[model samples]
Target: MAIYLVGDIQGCYDSLCVLLDMAAFNPQHDHLYVTGDLVARGPDSLATLRFMQELGEHGHTVLGNHDLHLLAVAKGIMRPKARDKIRAILDAPDREKLLQWLRHQPLLIHNETKNETASGFVITHAGIPPHWTVREAKQSARDVEAILHSDRYLWLLQNMYSDEPSMWSSSLEGIEYYRYTINAFTRMRFLTMSGNLDMACKLSPDKMSDENLVPWFAAKRRETIKETIIFGHWAALGGIFQNNFLGLDTGCVWGGSLTMVRWEDGQKFNLSCPV
Candidate 1:
């Protein structure tokens, strides 16, 4: 069975279907790995949420920033943002079920089988920090995953944001600490050359400050994950760059296109949206 790693859906339900058909996806046989941002921005978040809930029963979804935000809004912990189009999902009958499913989703996934030793995988919604080893990154993710998979998840989600140490810290406090940690994993884009996060800027690296700001992947990091990583959420990164990691969120909600990648070979495909 082939595994098709899909990019951000962002509530473009019709485009998702078209892309799936184009991939010849057979959920009964092949697995679907989604990079998250399952809902928001587009017109059909309720449809996206339901469809993802169904697909996730048989597939895998790495939680994106949008997915987490949806949960926050659903729980009344936060309000809607400028680009969010999740009203339908918030009003849906099965909203609770969908949020529960999203909470249970992971932040990272990998398959370091005997397949491509040079490049296996380590999937997250956004890119990983350069300083953290693959093991370090996975462990941080696991910490949040535990909270997500636990009964105390509601507590964590309510306080999941911060301006903390500004770098990875082993001894963190409150759920807010963990929130910042997860945020970087799922929403990070620009990084200083020193490896600190530049969270304010949303422009591509080219348009950012010339100081030390660079794409997260551009860091001359110590290579721990010696495999190809696939992620989304930074639409500014565009799709499929540097021939190592894959950024699949081509901003379909902003008139970009939905994207998909063949897991084993890395072939690419997309479907355009009107935004």
Candidate 2:
């Protein structure tokens, strides 16, 4: 049984199907680890959610920022934007089931195996913060996941839309703590030299003029630097493969290609999006 880690699908179901076909994916045999952003921005979100839900145990996805936004919109905490394209999912007959499935998804997936020279990997929608170690990140994610799956989730979703507390601190508590953890796992991209999140800069490294803002993975003395992190959300980076960081968002919804990485051998597969 193979495990394929795929980039953000957004709502591009056709590209997802084509990429799976190219990979010869067998739902019954192979496992799919999705980098999240499963529904939004593209067409066919309902179909995409249905397909992923049907995959059951064979498929897993980390919750992305867009995915969280969907939950907020569904709960009337936020209004749907004109470009969201997720109305189909909210209006679908199986909306409850789909949202339930999405809510149950974690913000972080850590699989540490003994095979292939102690191979282990962590998957998140955006990326883990430089301040938290791999184990710490996982624990923080669990803390928030509990709230998300609990009865108080509606309150959390309603209050999760702020960028305050832009830095990590162990002393943080309450909804602010959870919000920071969520941002780290779902919206993080770059960090200031002092290890504080630089939320405003979304441009790629080459395009950015600020030298103080470093990619989260490139921060000095990052505790999780040794851990292999697989993440999406930075489509501008376009499938960056570094020593320990694997970026899989290739902008399929923006006329790029859908990309996936076979976990066993680290072999990559791609299917170009239609023009």
Candidate 3:
């Protein structure tokens, strides 16, 4: 069975279906792993949520920033923005089920299969921070996931909105630790020269005017990482294919192409989308 990794659907259900058909994905055999942002900014979020939910174990996803936002809105911690385009999901009768599934999703997924290459891959919403090794990132993700899946999840959803504590520290505690972990896994894009998250900039590296800021992937990474890092969330990246990192968000909802990569062979499939 083939394993496929697709970029953010962002509620572009039609485009996602067409792209998956082109890939000849078989839910019975082939598994589909999403880079997250399963809903938002496009049409038919309800349908997208339903389709992915029905895929059951065959479809796996890590939580994206938008996904978290939806949960927050469901909990009345936040209001839905017009551009978010998620009202249908919030209004659906199965809203609780969909939100529960999304709420329980992890922030990181490590797929290091023994049958494949020794070093498999790790998928997160954006990318892993350079400060943490893969093991540290995984553990940090579990910490937040535990909260998200527990009674304190409402507290987390209520308090996870800050951009502070931009730098990571082992001594970080309480909300700082949870917020930092969430930001690093989902919202990270650029890092200041001092290796702190630059939460404001979303421009591609070439168009970046700040010379002091580097794309997270361009920063010096921890030397212990051996597995490939796969991520989405930066539509401006277009699609980055480097030595050990792959970015698949091609901005399908913004008139770019929906993109997916076959994990076993690294073959890519794309479908052009309209604005």
* lDDT for 192 (candidate 2): 88
Which numbered prediction scores highest in lDDT against the true structure? 3
lDDT per residue as tens, model 3, 173-223: 999999999999999999999999999999999998999999999899766
Residue by residue across 5-56, what tens digits does model 1's lDDT show? Answer: 8888889989988998998888888888889888888889788778767864
Q: What tens-digit string does per-residue lDDT give for candidate 2 at 1-275?
A: 88899999989999999888988899999999999999888888889889999999999999999999999999899999878899888888889999999999999999876485437889999988877788898999999999999999998999898887888889999998999999888999999888887789889998999988899877765454566889999999988888889999999888888899888888889988864
Q: Which of the two candidates, 2 or 3, achieves a greater TM-score against the reference?
A: 3
How big is the positional error of residue 186 in model 3, measured in Å on the Cα after superposition? 0.8
Q: Pick the candidate with the highest TM-score.
A: 3
TM-score of candidate 1 on Cα atoms, chains taken together: 0.92
lDDT of each: 0.80, 0.90, 0.93
Residue-level error in angstroms, candidate 1, position 196: 1.4
Ranking by lDDT: 3, 2, 1
Scored against the true structure, residue 118 in model 2 reaches a CA lDDT of 36
Q: Is candidate 1 or candidate 2 better by TM-score?
A: 2
Clashing pairs in model 2, backbone N/Cα/C closer than 3 A:
none
Model 2 compared with the native: what TM-score? 0.97
